[model samples]
Target: MQTEYRYITESLAINDYGSGDRELVSVNDGPGELDELFQRVGFYSASHDFRELCGFIRRFPKIGPYNALLLHIQRPGCTFVATAKEWKTDFNRTVKPGARPLVILRPFGPVNFVFDLQDTDGPDPFPEDLLEPFKIHDRSREAECRYALDRLLNAVPADGIAFYPSDFSTAAAGYIETAGIGSWQKFRGHQLKVHYNHVVSRNLPPVEMFASVLHELGHLYCGHLGTVDKRAWPDRKHITDAGIKEFEAECVSWIVCSRMGIDSESEKYLADYLDQNSRIPDISLEVILKAAGMIETRIKKGIPVPKSMKIS
Candidate 1:
């Protein structure tokens, strides 16, 4: 059965993660209020995907539901403080200056975690250059990275998980060390690297970008990266190896995009690649469909292995 989880707080006080000027207030104002507020928030609003909230709930299973409380505030300053239980009795409590309290209430269920949004800052959901992936300086195979990304993330089927879209392509079209520190996609302590170039020409279409993120998420969903040999591929026998790589990524991207009713450029790009590989019978839609079915099952059951499903 689907796990039924909810944010049982009576109200939600949210601000611009850290901006001192807290402007909006979101509460469980019932259906009508939610609808009106959503109309103002638009589709890509921060709260649109309740997956994060679900993560929050799961992380802190100790917090009671109906009995829990929500604290919403306007100015949750740098020193904004929070906790699961009473600070004075159950735990320690100390409010220092320079901090603002946005919301202060007991959660409805057992307490697992309490986050002061100020501490755990995240990326701004909307950025001007978010679509940089579509633009590339090189027209070589690197140009296909975004298209490959789209197929990998959105085309795969996975439950309760998704990949975040990123425009930071690398100069190495095959593999390179990621710069900076503490990046999320790091594998083996290295930032998740791919065989793509950092070229920019145009932003990936919004639907395509979203689909790309989902498609990459599928790679993670199926644990394809963790288990599958980085170099060994099923279609290594084909003359069009690049075509084969794109096909795998695209097949996953198409599956996730189709399942969620998202706009996918899969049909367009896949058709182009397939045309070039007309001699390869294994690169057919029937093969794609077979792979997708296997991916879908892995995502649904939360199986974290490539062996979970056999693509027959």
Candidate 2:
């Protein structure tokens, strides 16, 4: 698809999706939502110390991300954990007779319990690699990460939402830029308003830019900024607590970023946010994952969303 717009001095009109090298294409598939496991894990991941949690994820690459997080919360500072059978088979060790077990969700069956290596009787047979924090000595994700961000931004859905770069400060990365309070999109023949336009900072890297846009979109899509169309999104502006809005948006950003293997600052930001508060905010897990799934499906391919070309 081809879109054209001239960059103005103060305001930008980014009607274009590509710069000759890349172009947008339309798709017929609908977006997806996170499953129940992710729905629960995603919430916990956001509120906790995810930077350290990510370390656990790195240390235990075999366990899934959700399981890693579960292990981190249930047992902090745990270097390695394994099932009793795995300990006996993989490391030739055995769990103590009655060592307390840590629980993790099992995808196919009931919950499972794991024993930490310290709780097991082993001869310390691990090589240096197993003892040290696993690091990629031969390669890095720099190139793939850059491409992921580009692909993410380029796959922006065309649902009356237009993204443009702005001179936003370091304190603020980006924000929603609408024509007015009730912006409308003209689709087929009908015209209706939507509050989905965005403005990201030009100074940010691909990850930061993608994250900034998602944060802003999260606010609008999650109905923190008042929903003009309840059918498209909900109307949750009644949630007067600003922390709740920020929490939900960061959760969306963290989930999507984690999916792409790009560690975003949302982990740090959300962790810090919780440190200053006494209790966790009342957030909607369903909405957060729904928003994340929508963004995820859009970035999967160059798909034109069900939107209109006319905006007013």
Total backbone collisions for each predicted model: 46, 2
Q: Where does candidate 2 have its weakest 10-residue lDDT segment?
A: 1-10
Q: Write out the backbone clash pairs for model 2.
A: 183-193, 184-193
Candidate 2 C-alpha lDDT tens digits along 183-261:
6654435454454677778877666777777788777766677654444556677888987898889877876665455
Model 1 residue 206 distance off true place after TM-score fit, in angstroms: 5.3
In order, candidate lDDTs are 0.32, 0.58
RMSD in Å for all candidates: 18.9, 14.7
Return the TM-score for each candidate structure. 0.28, 0.51
Model 1 vs. true fold: TM:
0.28
Q: Judged by lDDT against the true structure, how good is candidate 2? A: 0.58
Could you tell me how far off, in angstroms, the CA of residue 259 lies in candidate 1 after the best superposition?
4.0
Off by over 4 Å in 2: 1-146, 181-195, 275-278, 302-304, 307-312
